[model samples]
Target chain A: MTIDLFQKTGAFAENKDVARDIRVRDIIPALERHEEVILDFAGVGAATQSFVHALISDLFRQYGNGVLDRVAFRSCSEAVKQIIRIVVDYMQEGMGIDTEDAPEA
Target chain B: MKIHLPNSAFLGNLDSFLRGFDSTHPDHLEITANDQWIAVHPVVLSMIAALGLTVKPGNVRCGPLQARSGHYVVRMGLLKILNIPSSITMVEHEPAGRFIPLTQIRTSSELTSFITEMIPLLHVESEQAKTIGYIVSELVRNVIEHADAEHGAFLCAQYYKKSHSIRIGIADTGVGIKATINKSHEAATDLEAIRLALWPGVTGMTRRDGGTAQNAGAGLFFIKSIASVNRDFFVIYSGSGFYKLLKPSPTRRLRLNADPFGDRHSKRDDLPFWHGTAAGVDITLDQTKEFAVLLEAIGTTYRTALRERKNARYRPPRFL
Candidate 1:
């Protein structure tokens, strides 16, 4: 399942409500069906960490850390990729799961 | 309540102005201004607007404005939002590339709309717009989701041509930080509540290491990190607790601190009690570090903060 984030979030995706909507309506269903989900950020300008957290933090809680393997972030700008990484790494840290690739401060 | 607008009140000298606020009477507000000139931060206008909203319209009073810059507040829409009849009149012009006047946002969708319209109004570059949008989104959402404010969040911003910085202010009248953080954790004082709120992975919603999916308690941490990297002033006040992140000197090495107190900052737990929260951030456009780099720094601090918090809960084997 390919999710065109720009289509829903415009250039900058900061609305948590919209993020929650996408999560409940699409992402969770695809992951539950054992299908891969692509979050495409080709034209999206930026995304808040809160928005990204609202979108996928629950997946880590429900499906465990394995959800990282199922979700693919495609065509993300460096900024978007870093934000996604922040949310992912911190959630893992809070869960007490070790991550080898965490970046330096 | 009485609030005196001093000659100047930007975040740097905002302490005295905050100290001047009389939050005694809940039914009425008395506003006085410096006779010669009144130049203040956007947060001051937001704070006054937020306060005025709580009072009965007729009960609120503003003495004659002798300041030459009284029209500045008028242009910012302070009088209109509060429904106060103002004697001062000024020609209105295009707001583009200038300012976001006083706006009240109550719902999530309203905030989304405000962000959409605000970027263009400021006429900033794409990268700068991202930072402004992110700040507005996270801050307003925090108020919407947690503050439980009836009047919602009042927001405004001004772009300073001389400094090349965007000054943004947001204020809300709701259950203050102490009440909110106390829901899940034991915050002994409002200052303790502000401290706990700044720490990553700590939320009033739940004490779980990783917050509930909807919230990770990392919003304020990210904001403070952005300002810290840029070496700009960031101020937040709720109840009698106030925290200000002082701009680091240029000669010092740039670093991100998971604990807000670890960063050079000024804190006050004795200020007049504000029923809700008022926050202001100055983003120097030229000094904006690459968004990617800022996030990487934030990632490190946040992850480290969470790990330390998690490890604190671990128990070692006891002696026989």
Candidate 2:
């Protein structure tokens, strides 16, 4: 499942409400079906840390380190990629998991 | 009683002006100002008018204060914006002070509009404008999500052309930091509450009202990181606790009885207490400071810290 984040939430995804909508409507359902979800960040100007955290922190906590395998983030700008990395590392630390061996998105 | 306008109408003097209102006898109060060399920002004037509505309502009147050339036009514009009837008749003109009036952020659309309108007035380039817009938006969102302010949030911004810096202030009359953070953690003092709040991933909204995922708690962390990196001024005041970062070294935490702007470099904690939370950001308008570069640097720092921690956790036991 390829989820174009820009198409889903417009170019700038910073609001938590938009993140909640994306998670409930797209990401969670894809994971439930065991589908490999790809978050496409093409044309996205920026994704705030709060938005990324809201979108995927729960998923990471629920599935633990295994989430990296099922979820792939592509076409991310350096800014967006850094934001995702921060969220991933933050959630990983909270769950007492190490990111040294986690698969790259 | 008649009150005279200060030569410079800046926000720093707001509290002093408010103190002049007589609560005992709201009526029979008058405001007068000699327009000669009087310089007032629009934000300050609008805020004063708003305060009038709250403090004395129709009991106050403005007496004739001679307005020099351009001052008359600006004064009329301010009165029009405040929707206050004025005896002075002048053509509508742009006020000297560039400001966004006090607005409520009830929806995301309103927030977006506010950001769009405010960024241009900051008088910075495209990238710098976007960065400041994001910071302002994030801070206001914090007010809506965390502060729980019944009256919502009030924001005011002013760009000091002479100083080459822009100062933004967001205030809320809400549950405050001590009360909110105490919900999720044991914050014994207001200072502790503020400290914990600034830490990444420490949020009072762990269990959201709608059972949604908790807030990332990185809002203030990001704000502080950017401010410190740029050597700008950032201050957060909640409850009785006041925390200020003046860039470089020396961040102070104090308690204030009122909302007087403390010395940016003061390193004390014995002031009075403010009722709610107020966040202020003062950043130099440097074109070279890009938001993406700042975020990348912050990410690298976080990664390095996490890597070190993980390495320590997994290292073999030390030799005897």
Candidate 3:
């Protein structure tokens, strides 16, 4: 399953409600069905840490650190990529994942 | 209540103006200004607007301005927003690339729309617009989600052509930081609450390392780090406590601190009581660091802070 992020959050994805909607309404359901979920950030310019956290942090908590393997972030700008890396790294760190397993920032 | 607008009150000298606020009477607001010339930060106006909403329109009393620059506040929409009668009449200039008049955002959708229309007000470059938009979105969302304010958040901004800086201010008359933060952690004073709130991974919602799914407890820390990297000023006032991040000396090398007090800052615990919270930040376009670089610094610092917090609580086998 693929989610067109720009269609949902515009160019700059700062709205947490929209991010939550994408996560609850789409991302979680796809992951539960054992399908890969691709978050397409093709036209997205910038995103807040809160928005990114809302979109994916709970999935890590619910499914553990392995969820990253089933999900893909597509066409992310450098800034958006950095933000996702930040949220993912800290979340894994909070869950006591070893430094070797956490994604690099 | 009485508030005296001094001749000058930017983030640097905003302490005096905050100290001079008389919040004794909860029902009436009396505003007086310097007679010679008046120049103040938008936070000053935001604080007043937030307070004015609490009292009846007839209860707000504004003394006539004798200063030449009193008309400036009129253009900023303070008098009109408060519904206080004013004799000063000035031509309303087009607000494009100048200033954002006083605005009250009460809902999440309102904030999203406000940012879409707000980016063009400063005529900034792409990088600068991202910083401004990010700050506005984070701060306003905090209010809507946690402030419990009936009238919501009041915010405004001004573009300084001379210094190429954008000054933004947001104010809310809610239950204040102490009430919100006390739900999860104990903060003995308002300044302590402010400190805890600014620290990464600390939220009123949970005491867990990373915040809940919806919140990471990082909004204020990121905003402060932006100002810190740029060597700009960021101030937060709630209750009688105020915290201001001072500009570092030009010769000092930049570093992000996990603890707000570890950075160069001034805090007060004895100022006049403000019922809610108000925050103001100054972003200089020329001095702005790249947003990506700033985020990297923030990420590193936040991770280290989280590690140290867990390690502190970790129990090791008895090493005799």
- The top-ranked prediction according to DockQ is 1
**Fraction of the reference Cα-Cα interface contacts (below 8 Å) that each candidate reproduces:** 0.92, 0.47, 0.78
Q: For all candidates listed, what's the TM-score of chain B alone?
A: 0.99, 0.66, 0.98
* Per-residue alpha-carbon lDDT of candidate 1 for residues B190-239, written as tens digits (9 for 90 to 100): 88899888888888999887788788888998899999998999999999
Model 1 clash count equals 0
Top candidate when judged by lDDT against the true structure = 3
Q: Give the per-residue lDDT digits (tens) of candidate 2, residues A12-88.
A: 66778878788889898999999999999998767778788778888876777688889999998777887888877
Residue-level lDDT tens digits of model 3 in B137-156: 99999999999999999999
lDDT per residue for candidate 2 within B251-271, as digits (tens), equals 543221111122233222333
lDDT of 3 at A64: 89
For all candidates, state DockQ relative to the true structure. 0.84, 0.45, 0.83
Off-target runs (Cα >4 Å) in candidate 1 are: A101-105
List CA RMSD, all candidates. 1.6, 6.8, 1.3
Q: Candidate 1: TM-score?
A: 0.98
